[model samples]
Target: MSVVAVVLTALMFVLLGPVAAHAGAGPRDTGSQPVDSYANAIRQSVWVDTGLDGDRDGKTDRVAADIIRPSEPAAAGRQVPVIMDASPYYSCCGRGNESQVKTYDQSGNPVGFPLYYDNYFVPRGYAVVLVDLAGTDRSDGCVDVGGASDITSAKAVIDWLNGRATAYTTRTGSTTAQAGWSNGSVGMIGKSWDGTVANGVAATGVEGLKTIVDISGISSWYDYYFAQGAALYDGGPDELASEVESSGAQSHCSAEEQALRDGAPRNGDWTSAWQDRDYYANASKVKASVFVAQGMQDLNVRTKNFGQWWNALAANGVQRKIWLSQTGHVDPFDYRRSDWVDTLHQWFDHYLMGVDNGVQSQPMADIERTPDHWSTDPVWPAPGTAATQVGLKASGTNGLGSLSAGAPPASGTERYTDNPAQDEDDWAAQADQATASKVSFTTGTLASDLRLSGGGTVTLTATPTTTSAHLSAVLVDLGPATIRNYEDGAEGITTLNTRSCWGDSTSGDSACYLDTAADTENVQQTVFSRGWADLGHYDPSLHGVSLTPGKPYTITIQLASTDHVVPAGHRLALIVAGTDNGLIVAPSTKPTISVDLSRSSADLPLVGGLPALAHALRGGSGHHHPTATTPAATPSRGPAAALPTSQAARLR
Candidate 1:
């Protein structure tokens, strides 16, 4: 085994020791107080060396941290577990549904911390640490984005909490301090960028990290900025680095910023830099139980981040739970308020306090069916779900087609030219049978509600007129709909003129927050999911294989996972095009492409035996029904065969 692998394996054995015996039990009572009781908590700030000199200052860079803990525990000689949120946005962009930024006193001690974490957890017998990631806020170093420095800086704080590292009241102070009242157990929790740091730190095989709660976070920085060899936006790594770096003299970190850009080129290829940032690549090193909450429609971080990470964790036998929602890029607190707080309390109580709260025996997955409705299941993508391949066949002359159960006839093809100016909505809006920029396929009215419960795959054989092209596949719902207006409420909440209180308040912060109203939009149709691919980079992520012009090549694109119900009479549609104007950078050269109808199909994972019912609904025979003016085309593989209606009904 590789050196890193061997070390990680050894570390896993060390960390996993004895935990299985009391998997769902709480720690022994050491004068532990009730979770609801308030204690007079002390607030302070500290700086720890991360053992890195990104700015070439001849000494290791120091990271800034704001800490709050119950004074009673220290007075009683009791150590408490810590809850840490290390982020770059603590000072600038703020946090939570209200975007509350951290407030400081004249002496540099934190007086007001963003979000409800410190206010709620500190009084409940936990220490809350809000850290300024290296190079951002008051931390001294260059922002390395999601590189080694970023991960290591956060890890150092955990090291200090566990008495393995040194810290000080000031960056260059001679006096030193240690976390004397900490039990050496830490739980990291945050949303978005903060949660992303938690995932990265956990993947470092760090000791004393008991659990992590990642909400709508990215597991792979490469995937966040690129998709199938295409850059998601115009500027690459340097632009992003500059955006997140502290507001100050840019020349201080110019070299570091340039390094980021050089590491992540515009070609969308993975380098060692991206590999270092990918928590999924290092998932084997994670020893903490994970709880993830993400929106299926989160366009910012995207659903693939959570889905792929969850799958990797499962494969590695890591204990985990998830909350999948329909809202776009939203946090569980905004989507499901009361239940979220309660569940979180139980989760932390079990993991950090070792309390046997029966949290482990509960359902592992909670999925949203609508804005206000939810369903619980033992596992995500439910156990009995099966993948059903719905074939695409040419329909009318205007690029419109049909979703068929069987393959198309031997003689049919659809063609379209890449349009850089067209976005996903523009392509989806082409209901007319003759739009030249894209091709669309629609299924017949459903006989019953169809619940698609997992990730989807799109396979197609096509020949591009040019050597390269960008392909975008969209899975859409073809029916009138009213859905959460995630685009407008990018933060997932709108502050109303009213306010309400949830829990007890303190002098520096309040448990009360401005009331938020849900935003919804009505549309004729909605694009449920989409995936993208670049024809040239079909071989591997870092390597590009040049495509031969006019040569047929089969490409498979993995669609984002989702759990949505297509009501009866609603048709499932698939749109194939060369560009998603809003989500990706279009190819510079527009290429004409022809798709082989017989070889193109989409594999959808639906709940129960919906595949059998789909065949029956599309005319008992597994063939396209003949139109009034045209005869039914012959299936390339075989003649149309029929299944017993009784059997189909039974399966349904």
Candidate 2:
């Protein structure tokens, strides 16, 4: 090799380094690369004009966009790809671990961005733009709360980058600002609400957007607030809209806020406004490759968002990758740390910079099997996994039914009354209690490890004693182990005192953040999957039907997607009840439910199907006295006959 080849070869090793097994597509690389002293980068702000006037101010709504770019790429020099994060929380609750808000100088130039995106990517020749969603921060409009204004505001920025929209140097100034430094390749990324906006923007099928990284994002607002016609909150988007509104924009946004309340009523019916906020409806229009990271046990955004979005992306044949963590609502930066930054670096380089770094060829799913232990698979739901139905039989030595494989239970009935006071935590802890409020079915100890790979549904064939019924299903692992305590902690990870830096630092901002570790705990059992449904909404539609009090309805509760393992010697329990208190709103009338044991079953996504489940249920029924880990059978709280009984032979 010549001397020039030697210098270039050495630089490749330095820039690419040894990432988490990510390799570039040979040495014939192109485009701008990372440089030193990247701390001294260009910083500025602009206002993008969205076509919608959500606040009815007689002018187009404008979004606030702050930008930072490397210095080497002069304003009129070689163009570079852009990395953007459009968020509504920049001024309300802030972003990241320390809640770092955007800092600006007197000239309105951005001095700092919330997270490490700008610091790490700017030096790597990518311009990082932080956009404030319309109606929040310095943006002009009412908060739309995942509606047209919320999505179109972010879409306008991508339009500007692609030369389809206009941007002004000042909010009120007529002077225009051009993205001359942009090559029209843009990648969107963020966590939580910010990530959701990225999903919304990509759904628009806009030009210039190359890829998006959505971490713990909601693909649909209806899914976020309602599940199968069951309200997850007492109030809906109106509360959230108020929380993220601009300080002085409440009066301007009052009508919009009232519209949220009207569109999303407490009765759990979907509205046209919700369809406008649902990105999954337009998933077929997405032109950009997608990278999704979600928490399997994410109660806030919930796993169904990713499950639905993933299905849509697959149906559309869109390029995609995923990271399913064993934590709760958290950013990959907080959980995976170094590997997240490394993989993200390669992802942007591949999609945005047009570098074939072999990212697309790698395993599509990176799932955390255990706490802090990750495994990669070519596809999610493990390729060979299949849906298997397990019957609930009332034949166990314990009072609960036995989950057996074969034909559905032929001739048994189990009844449970509605109890809105006891939640999943209370139910899981009292599994042996013979309370009429809840019923449970348990599988024998697994002789071998049985893995559940994807999403499934707990379908019940039953009759309700009242006109309306709200039901909940819980899948629990009856074994002691340490697990991420995402049930209590909202973020699912705790920040430590120690700090780690990722890129070059400036006077106003540093690339460093407090290190985080999984918030874990030793538990007797872990509730891995849960689903809720309203019996009145048996068709799984937004509207509820008025059913006769004693009519049997086929209700399918779609389980939240998960990747969990039932270890050999551990038992699996399925708890059936009504109204997950504190989690979702209860029905107006708490009615007792009667389920046909032989007809009801949980359709599970088992990695090995019947053979794997059979092997796990081996070893002579695996029933005996409670082990050191299993909770001993407790006393019953109330007699089973205490529930209301009707002439239809159903318990109420």
Candidate 3:
């Protein structure tokens, strides 16, 4: 159901109380105002303009907002807890009569109301302020996403609130109970853009700001727009732009209005303004207790945002918490309304009101993955984690085996040609179809249960027939019952910044070294650019080619961190190919890939008996029991294999 419907249902319960058998008691207000009456329900919407002289001009930037409050006060004579919901990608679904409450952005693509904000907190006695930020909707000035001015706009909302409650009550009298009762305590909450603003303003250390709940927020724009060591995927951003820009225009707003909201990078305003607004500048300066929520599947913001701030909070010893869900972008899990609503209230109560809601005592982190139910670890990755590499020995078509310590052909190789044309839309062969690639290999059925709650790396030795070749790899959880493929950095521009439980960057050197220690907390990602060298004029000996047709060379591909569990019957398969759906631009114009199987293998560090140390540090959960005997080396052995005679034949 929509957030509106849910709010209404919750409102009914709050207003009528005991709807049925308690008919003798009749309907009561339950200490709240009547739902139908606008005054009683605090349903009247009004736009208040905050006078801020941003440009140092004689005139001020009139920052306007829609104030939605409860009809009656939760606590008389005390300011009710106030939450500021940053308006959506556009200005709509707010209380302003001048602006229609609709989903269309200024351009005309349909945008959802920040219903998660509008309805989620009102019933809980928190007055919500939804601002039509500068240059979007009814507000003035050009929009600058992730810029300093954008942050100023957010702080202006707070400044407006700190002074508006008294003015509102004096003008409207006690009937404006929400304004009258508000203790003036305030907090910031939102997802995505709003979340960004929350983090931004928190850095200012403004008074009345007690807590911030940032969900799906990006801490650094550079890390988001251009992942470290990777290119940007044109598809996702383009689609979002088309939707927002078109919808804003369809809403009948001025073309300039819509442009401000949807055309940031294109207009060059945001780029120019955000150059100095990086999160690393002041992320550690935020004094407010913070709670962050992130999605494991979030392709846009990813884990770096949380990783950055969370680590900062830890290093500074500030109170902080994080929760990861399987959803994408926004809350995708369809969390229960009560759980969602109460979480906000509890957070605010604990911080803003000092109500000891036990939010801190609850799980510091709740991470859930397939085959493994939700597990709460005080530390992320649960510490003392190990990565085991399962080697692959190729045979004909399907006969692939494990890696043995001693093999006769300790340096044999395999070659394949990747067709770049395969990359395409969602489910398109190029995007994620692992079975459609040239350099293909499989893994044997699992001998035991395997659960990888962290990141993994793939290293191999390759000799390109051309000057360079684009390589891609994927890890698949293949059980007898099901098979699911996980992607590596081989496809398109991928985010190289990954966070460990400690909120530190686990990214490696040069984007491929798989370094487990780095200040990911607000550091920019490093991207490697692919360049072409004429193959006819290129000298392999000069290019540091350790791998010959009969020799070996090593190439490493990095996969972002993840928390997942593989069941007992499942096989962890890695597939390598030349083209990665156009996401990975080859080092040269024409690409060919040949892998030396023997000398080429993933370097997965195994922490032998680290489980004991883990127990000592984190205490026993009874689930992390380690074996006494040394784990055997599972080698990749298959039917005898042969090397290709020539590069052309292998390419064919």
- TM-score of each prediction: 0.87, 0.90, 0.58
Winner on lDDT (2 vs 3): 2
For all candidates, the clash counts are 8, 2, 40
lDDT of 1 by residue, 59-84 (tens): 78999889988776667577888999
255-373 in candidate 2: lDDT tens per residue? 89889888888777767878888999899999999999998877777788998898899899999999999877678889999999988988898888767667788899998877899
- Which regions of candidate 3 are displaced past 4 Å? 1-60, 90-120, 162-184, 203-207, 235-277, 303-315, 330-338, 370-373, 386-417, 421-447, 454-473, 480-558, 575-579, 582-590, 593-652
Ranking by lDDT: 2, 1, 3
In order, the Cα lDDT scores of the candidates are 0.75, 0.80, 0.45
Clashing residue pairs, backbone N/CA/C < 3 A, model 1: 25-354, 26-354, 26-355, 26-356, 27-354, 298-329, 398-433, 398-434
Question: Would you give me the overall lDDT of model 1?
Answer: 0.75
lDDT of 3 at 634: 22
lDDT accuracy of residue 16 in candidate 3: 51
* Model 3 lDDT-worst window of ten: 518-527
Q: Which residue pairs come into collision in candidate 2?
A: 409-598, 592-652
